[model samples]
Every structure is written in structure tokens, then in C-alpha cells.
Target: MKDLSDKALFALVQDHDERAFAVLLERHSGLVYDLVYKRTRDDDDTKDILQDIFISLWNNREKIRIEESIYPYLHRSAKYAVIDLAIKNQRVTAYQSLLAKQDEPFCHPAETGLIASELQQQYEQEVARMPGTMQQIFRLSRDQQLSAREIALQLQISEQTVRNNITLALKKLRLSLGSDQLIVLLPLSLYISSALAVN
Candidate 1:
């Protein structure tokens, strides 16, 4: 098992051989960690993304085809994981920044800082009302700045499920926040619309 090639281990992994999967994870973890850490520069985020990659590998093992070393696949996956984290973090930062500035003077009365503060409270209330799992997913995305893959790995769910919950959560927020809130929030309204459209 220790000496098996990536292809060989992956073949066993497809067959549900836990030992083979463990071997593959052990053999390639350092490489993935190095790649992820270089891009992310945060140890915790690096480990989280590393877990996401292998969990992704194990989850998708049946569909994954490897002709040689899994190094290439792992490398590509690491890059994607970093990109995923960055995108999620960017979205979180943008929205949080908007929230943070809610008290700053903006435009009219309803669109004023007071209204923005009220909107922030209202948004939190809406988030609190979300279904337990969806709320957890949303918080992980917004507060912890974790990607869908990272959230899924942490929650032991599929990435698609994580994405779906996030989409639904955002939709709920849009509806609850209303167009008036959007008008007051400036950029977040635009971000929300674009995010929903893009997702």
C-alpha cells in the first residue's frame, strides 16, 4: 500500500478501500499543503483547503480518472481551492465592509446612515430566522469566510448542497432586506443581484 502508485491507490479508492485512500491522503498531503499554503499564506485556511481537496477527491473518486501520478490532479485542485477561498473571502469582505459602513452618511433620509443601521439589524434578524442548517451555512460563508467547498467539508455535506443552501440563504436575505434596504445599502444591493445572477 505504501509503495503503490497513485493510479493503483486511486483504483483501490474507487473500490472503497479505506487503507488505499488513507495512503493516498498521506502521500499527497504535503504536496497539497505546500501548494495551498503558498497561495493562501494562512495556516488554518491552508489546512482547511487541503482537507477540502482530499475530501473532494474521496467524494469524486468514482468519477476521477488518473493515468499517472495524482500530483497533477492535486496540483490543479489546490489551485482551484485557493481560487474558491479567495472568491468567497472577497464576497464576504465586500458585504461586511458595506455593513460596517452602514452608520456613515450616504444619501437621503431612508437611504441615510440611520436607515442603514436599521437594515443591518434587520438583516441579522432575518439571518437568525433562517433554517438551522442554512443559517449555519450562511454564517460560515459570511462570518468565517469559508468557501462552499470548505463549508461542505466541515459540515460533511456535498459542495452542491453547500452552494444550494448559500444561494437559498441569499435569496431569503434579498427578499427580507427588500429593495428599500438595497437602495440604502448602495453597493451590497448591486453585489447581491450580481451574485444571485452569477450563481
Candidate 2:
């Protein structure tokens, strides 16, 4: 197994051969870890993302094609996994900034209620217009206060899928409600982003 080519190992993996999978991991994990660590910098995040990459590889092994080499496939997967971590981290920072700004006075009590109500209505309308899956994902993350991991587990999907759906939902809501309304929704967004970050 150790002497087998990547294509051969992958073929065995596709056949559910655990020894082949182990050989492939032994051969490629160092490179995958290095690629992911370079992008992440944080040891903890790198470890988590590296594990995710392998889990993803195993989950989608049947669909993977190995015409020439497996290096490109592993490289691309590592890159994307790191990118997803980066995006999630950026959202956490943004959410923290927005949370800090929440301390400053923005409006009078009466105006605050009116603005929040209007924003809530617009948010609901925009969500209603989303695809059913997107709406469910958004609600799970936002309204139900579930972490991306939690939502992913509940829905039996990848965390990336949950994040993508939430991102799309936010984009659609922003486009429909305008950037100005984002302020009113900041608290909710912050909550969701923070939840995702922690998990």
C-alpha cells in the first residue's frame, strides 16, 4: 500500500479499503497540514481545518477524480478549507466590531423601536423570498441561535454549506433591505457570527 501510486490508493479508498486510506493519509497529510497551516497561522484553527479537509475527502471520495495526480486535488481542498476558516474568522471580527459599536448611542428609544420593527419586517420579507433551504439555514443560525456546526449536524450537511447559505441569506437581505438597515440587524448578525466563530 505504501508503494502504491496515489491513483491506486484512491481506487482502493473508493472501494472502502481502510489500509489504502491510511497509506494515502500518511503520504499526503504533511503537505496538506503545511498548506493549511500557512494559510491559517493558528495551530488550533489549522488542526481543525486539516481534520475537516480529510473528513471532506472521505465523505466525497467517491466523486473525486484522479486522472493525473492527487496532489492537485488535495492542494485545492486544503486551500478551500483554509479559505472557509478565514471567511468565518473575518465574520467574527466584523461581528465583534459591530458589537462594540452597539455600545454607542444611535437613536432615541421611540425611534429605535420603530427602526427595529421596520428592519425586522424587511428582514422577514427578504427571508421569505429566499429558497427554502436558505431560509431554513438562516433561521437555524440566526433566529434559533444555532452555531454553524450545530446547524450542519442537525441538517446532516457540511459546516461550509451552512456558512454559504447564511452568507447568501445575508447578501440577499442586504440587497433587498439596503446597507442602512444592516445597523438594525447588527445584533442578530453578531449573535449568529459569534456562534459560528465559537464552534
Candidate 3:
């Protein structure tokens, strides 16, 4: 129940206790999502990754060795998953680009541009899912390139409130992003870094 620690729950799960597995999932779902989101920055990928993480844990349940904190084990698994995906994506993108150049004298620019734009929109919507006030503050500060004080003045809130909102936004964003991902594109990295500087 509420008194059980993660270690105990994990131990039980290793012993084939289904309730323990449920508790483990409930406890760490956000962490898993955060890691996946940080890695893929795609809703569908995140969902897939989340499912994969749990499936992996279940499949390897008998072999899990949690002598210390269970968090690092989860973190390590999430990180390796991201790295694996990133490598796969790089290979796929490169192959696609090569095939496109070989097949077409002119690249199909519109189709690619539309897909990129849709992904960007999805990323923004994910950001917006944080607390409403934090979302507003983050958008104003990052997208508008406004300072915290300037945001406070425009929104008619205290400067400290602006600062707090930005901080909360970054924390939530970072937690959602998990630990191992860094946006590789300069513009996207700049945008995400500015919005989630604290994380």
C-alpha cells in the first residue's frame, strides 16, 4: 500500500506480484514519459517508448538487481532506450535523404516542410499542457523573447510571479523531457533551452 517503498514493491514484482507491477507503473509513469518525450519529442514515440519500457521491465523482471535505489535502474534503461532510438533515427534519416537525392532531381520540399511544421505544432502543444499560468509565462518569455520583468508588466503580475512561473514551467518541462535528450537543431534547442533553462 502507501507504506510500501519502491524497493519492496519492485521485489514483489520480481516475485510475480501483479499488484506490485501496477504500483511500479503508477509510480514511474511520469518519469518514463518524461524520458521518452525528451528523447523523441513526439507524442506517438513517447507512448510507444513508455509501453516498451514496461514491457522490457516485465520481460526482465526475474533478472532485475536492485541493491540500491531503483531510480537509477529506471533512468539508465530510459537513457539507453533514447540513445538506441536516436541512432536508429539518424540512420533512417540519412538513408531517406540519400534515396530521395538518387530518385529525384528536385527534392519534394512541400511534403517535408509540412511534416516538420506539424511536428513543431505538436511540440508546442505538449509544452502548453503544463500548468496554464506557467504555459503563458513560458510562451511570453521564450516565444516573445521578453524578460521576466517585462512579462510581469505586460501581464500585470508581480515580477516574482513571473520568475516563479518560469521556474515551474522549466521544472515541469525538464521532468517531462527526462534526463538524456538535448535538442540537436539550433533553433529548436534555443527555443527549448530558453523555455526550460532551469531544467
Candidate 4:
């Protein structure tokens, strides 16, 4: 396996040769990690994105086309993964800001209740739209009332990542729920922060 060229290793990998796959991983893992890390800059995001890249490579091995080397393909994959991550985060942030600006004072108790119900529905819908990892992180923090540290340990991720996911989740919720409805959801924010404080 060690004696095989890149093309040979890829051919073996496509043929279900685990040894070849391992060799390819070993040979290019550092390069892939560096490429992803340079784009993400955060240790946790880098690790998660790097793992996803390899998973994608393995899953799509049969479809891979390597004319000469695998470097270009891996590099492009890493770049696209990072870009997707950024776009997800940005969508969350933008939605949060837009929702924040829609804040207005409610006139009646009945109106408040109506808005709260609507916001809750919208929040659920938006959360459902999030990536699986983000959805899981958000639920653990919000529904389970877990602290960032606890959530990190449970998910086997960095506390920073847990916090980031939570932030993004809140932004997404805010965007979906709108600012006027956020006053109704104030307790939710308080609950999350309180949990964090305990941790």
C-alpha cells in the first residue's frame, strides 16, 4: 500500500480496499486539515469541517475522478465546505438582525398571546431548517437547558463551538420569531443564560 502511487491508491479505494483508503487518508489528512483550518480559523469548526470533508470523500469515492492527483479535489472540497459553513452562520446572523429591527410594543394581552404562539411556530420551523448538527446543539441548550460546557462534553466538541452554535441558534430564532415576539420569548433567553451561569 505504501508503495502505491496516488492514482493507484484512489483506484484501490474505489474498489473497497480499506488499506488503500487508510493510506490515502494518512497521506493527505494534514494537507486537508491545513486547508480547512486556514479558512475556518477556529479550532472546533476546523475539526468538524475536516471530519466532514473526509466523510464526503469516503462516501463519494466511487464518483471521484482523479486525472493526475487528489490534491486539487481535496482542496476544492475543503473550500466548499468552509463556504457552506460561513453561509449558514451568515444567514443566522442576518435573520437575527432583521428580526431585532421589527420590535414593537404590544397593545393587548390577547395580541401578545397570539404573537407568542405565532413566534413559537416560526421558531420551530426555522430550527427544523437548520443543519442537523446545529439543530442538535440548539435543542440541547434550549430544550434540555444544558450549559455550554455540558453540551460540549455531551457532543464531544469544544465549549466554544457549543457557545457558537447556541449564538447562531438564537439568531436564527430571533430572525424567525421577529423582534416584537422576542419580548414574549425573553424568558427563553434568560433560561439559556442562567444555565450558562450555572456552568
Candidate 5:
């Protein structure tokens, strides 16, 4: 494997050769790691994103095309991962700051009906806006009330992946919705966005 070029190794990997994939990991992970770490400045986050990158590679091996070095594709992957993480955190923070303004008296059910309906619409819209994996994690954890372990098992993904998504989902929801989901007392349908804060 050491003697094989990246194109050859990737070809073998596409054919489901685990050793070839391992060799590719050995060869390029450091480059990918440096880019991810530099963007995240957190070892733990870097590790999580890196694990996902490789796992995605293995899962999509049959479809990936490599002409020469694989570094370009890995670099692109790391860049997008960091951006996704940053955006999720940013959007979550913006919503939480609105919590203090929600002290308006609760409306009567009939009067609040339209506002409540709108709130539900926004909540569902935001959930749909989440990146694919995080969306799955949030829906399962929220609508189904599944534990992280259950979600991980059902998704055939790592528990850490479930946990990380949940943590970030909460963090971002706080920014995009509000802490405890008290956005102008809008009656949150996204109550589970705060799940990790207490846990």
C-alpha cells in the first residue's frame, strides 16, 4: 500500500479494500487535521469533524473519484465542515439573546392561535434548515424523544456523532430561537433545543 499512488490506492478503496482506505487515512489525515484545527481551535471539535470526514469517505468510497492526490478533496471537506459548525453555533446564539424580551402576558388560546401557528411554522422551518445530519439528530431527539444512544444506534452512526450534533443543535437553537425557547413567549415547539444544556 505504501508503494501505491493515491489514485491506485483510492481505486483499491473504491473496490472495498479496507487496507487501502487505512493507508489513505494515514497519508492525508494530518493535512486535513491541520486545516480543521486551525479553523476550530478546539481539539475535540477537530477530532469529531475529522472522524466524520473519513467516515463519509469510506461510506462514499465507491462514488469518489481521485485523479491524483486526494488532499484537495479532503481540504475542501474540512473547510465546509468548519463552516457548518461555525454557522450552527452562530445562528443558535442569536436566538438565545431574545429570551429576555419575551415577558409579554400569555395570550388567551383563541387570541394566541395565529401567533402560535406562526411560531410552529418558524420552528419547523428552522429545523428543516439544519444540515442533513443535525436535522436528523434534532428530529429524532425532539419529535420522537429518542435518547442519543438510541438515535446513534438507529442511524448506524457513532454515539459521539449523535452527542455532538445534539450539543451543537442546542447551541445553535439558542442563538436562532432562544434560551429555553422563550422567544417573545412564542410558545416553542422546539423545546428540545435546550436538551443538552441541562444534560
Candidate 6:
């Protein structure tokens, strides 16, 4: 039940303190699991990603120099880990195809739903245009269902900053698509296709 800062825990870990490492894992496991679950929506995959994150942390322990709060670094690491996992699983193409199929669901709708769906599509396309980091954050938080606090812990940003960035991104989508469209588009917006080409 020791509440060590990331720095202290990291130091102990560097000194080969297995107990310290376990404590670090216990404290952050929920954050890591939540972030992974949001991205994957699979219990088994979340467990896999959780193990991967901790293993990566332990393996890289000797190489990392932590002068700042370790939360953001760990969070960013988890974010990248999920992205890497997505690539390995070959899920990116399937996900994008699913998003692209939204047009089919929207077609049956008259005026209101049609416009909402079209605007949603446009918003998704715009989200696709964003840089990789933003898209990853967006997907992890929105698609994977991680809260800003969990995201900040996983990605290491201040929760306020997470809120601000997500807000800004959502605001842009809303302005472009209208409020009605945003509701329909939120989930699809998380499907980022640009990074899939490289993987």
C-alpha cells in the first residue's frame, strides 16, 4: 500500500526491486487496462495489452530517463502499444471498411437523418485528415472508451489538457457537421485510416 511517485517507483525498479515494480503495475494496471479496453473492447485483448505494456515497461526500464512525471510517458507508451497491436492484428482495414459502410445505414433516412449522416461522414473524413497522434488519442479515448483521467494516466497529459484537446477536436467536428451530425459521427470519427497504409 505504498504510494510512491512514479520517479520513486522507477528508481526502485532500476535497483532491481521486484516489489516496487509490482506496486507500479498494481497502481497503473487499471489505467492501462481501461485504455486498452477502450481500443479493443475485448477482455482477452485488454489483458494481452496490459501484459504487453508492463513487459515493455520492465524491458525498457534501464533505457528510460524519467525527469518528468512518468504518467504521461507511460500513457503515451500504452497509446503506441495499442496502435502497434492494431497493426499486428490487421484490424485497421476492417475497421475502416466498417466506417465507410456508414453510407448504407444513412441512405434509408429521409431529410434529418440523411443530413445528419452525411455531415457525420464528412466529420469522419476530416478526423481522418488529422495527424497520427491526435487520431490515436481520439481513438483510444473515444473508441476504446478511456476517460480523460485514464487517458492522461495512459498518455501522461494533464486531464485538463485531454479535455481541452478532445473538446477542440469535437468542436471542430461539430462546427463542420452540426450538433445533430456529431452524435452520429462520434464513433466513426475514431477510425483512422492514414496510419494503416504504413503498417
TM-score per model over all chains: 0.53, 0.52, 0.50, 0.51, 0.52, 0.44
**Model 1 Cα lDDT, one tens digit per residue, 36-76:** 89889998778767755776686688999988999899999
Q: Best TM-score goes to which candidate? A: 1
Cα lDDT of candidate 1 equals 0.74
Using TM-score as the yardstick, the better of models 1 and 2 is: 1
Candidate 3 residue pairs that clash: none
Worst 10 residues of 5 by lDDT: 190-199
lDDT of each residue in 1-199, candidate 6, tens digit only: 2677878989988886656776777677788778778988887666656655665676578888787456677788778978887775676577667868885653454766777666767767878976776766776777777765667779887654664566566667777766545544553322111111111
Q: Mark the regions of model 3 whose C-alpha exceeds 4 Å error after superposition.
A: 103-199
lDDT of predicted model 3: 0.67
Residue-wise C-alpha lDDT for candidate 3, range 1-199, written one tens digit per residue? 6458888988888886756776777778788788779768997666656655775676688898887556777788888888888897898798878887785644378987776676566566668797778888888876777765678779899755775676566556556553233132112222211221221
Give the per-residue lDDT digits (tens) of candidate 2, residues 25-138: 767878877888887788766665665566567668899888756889889888887777778679879977886788665577998788779878878887898999999998
| TM-score of candidate 4 against the unseen true structure | 0.51
lDDT (CA) for every model shown? 0.74, 0.73, 0.67, 0.73, 0.73, 0.66
Expressed as tens digits, the lDDT of each residue in 1-199 for candidate 5 is 6899999999998886766777788788788888899989997678768876886786677788877988888888899999999997787687665644568644667767887777677777877888999999878977687776678779999755776686677667667776535344332232222221222
**Each model's RMSD to truth, in Å?**
11.1, 9.4, 12.6, 11.7, 10.8, 14.6
Candidate 4 all-Cα RMSD: 11.7
lDDT of 4 by residue, 17-64 (tens): 656766777788788888888877887677666655665676688998
